[model samples]
Target: MNRAALRLSARVREVLEEAARRPDRGDISTTTVIIWVAAVTGAVLIAGTIALVIAKYNGQLNNL
Candidate 1:
């Protein structure tokens, strides 16, 4: 198992829990799940994009 990732995940969950404690924050209350979902989704998409870009350029280098 990846211990570093596990620790990160736990920290993220702890942050969300803290956010949940404040019901008066309009944005958080109205779109709590949406916030985190978007964050995680964006992170994944960004990482994938970086991987894809690197792979594409690396492939081109082989022909030079």
Candidate 2:
């Protein structure tokens, strides 16, 4: 290959290696984000279930 093509291939290899060695950002690791989302979703579902149950039983509780 010519000098220009050789230089470009070397540069691309360097860039790919640098990217592979880079650390992940703290804000958005896949597993961590998924766990947090699942926890929040569970909490919201529980809260909504409790609210619905309370509403359904409101009149019975009021009788006491």
Candidate topping TM-score: 2
Candidate 1 local distance difference test against the native = 0.87
Q: Estimate each model's TM-score.
A: 0.45, 0.58
For all the candidates, what are their Cα RMSDs to the real structure? Answer: 12.3, 7.4
Maximum-lDDT candidate: 2
lDDT of 1 at 10: 100
lDDT of each: 0.87, 0.90
TM-score of model 2 (CA atoms): 0.58
Give residue 20's lDDT in candidate 2 (0 to 100): 78
| lDDT per residue (tens digit) for residues 1-64 in model 1 | 6999999999999889988897556564548888989999999999999999989899787889
For candidate 1, give the lDDT of residue 22. 79
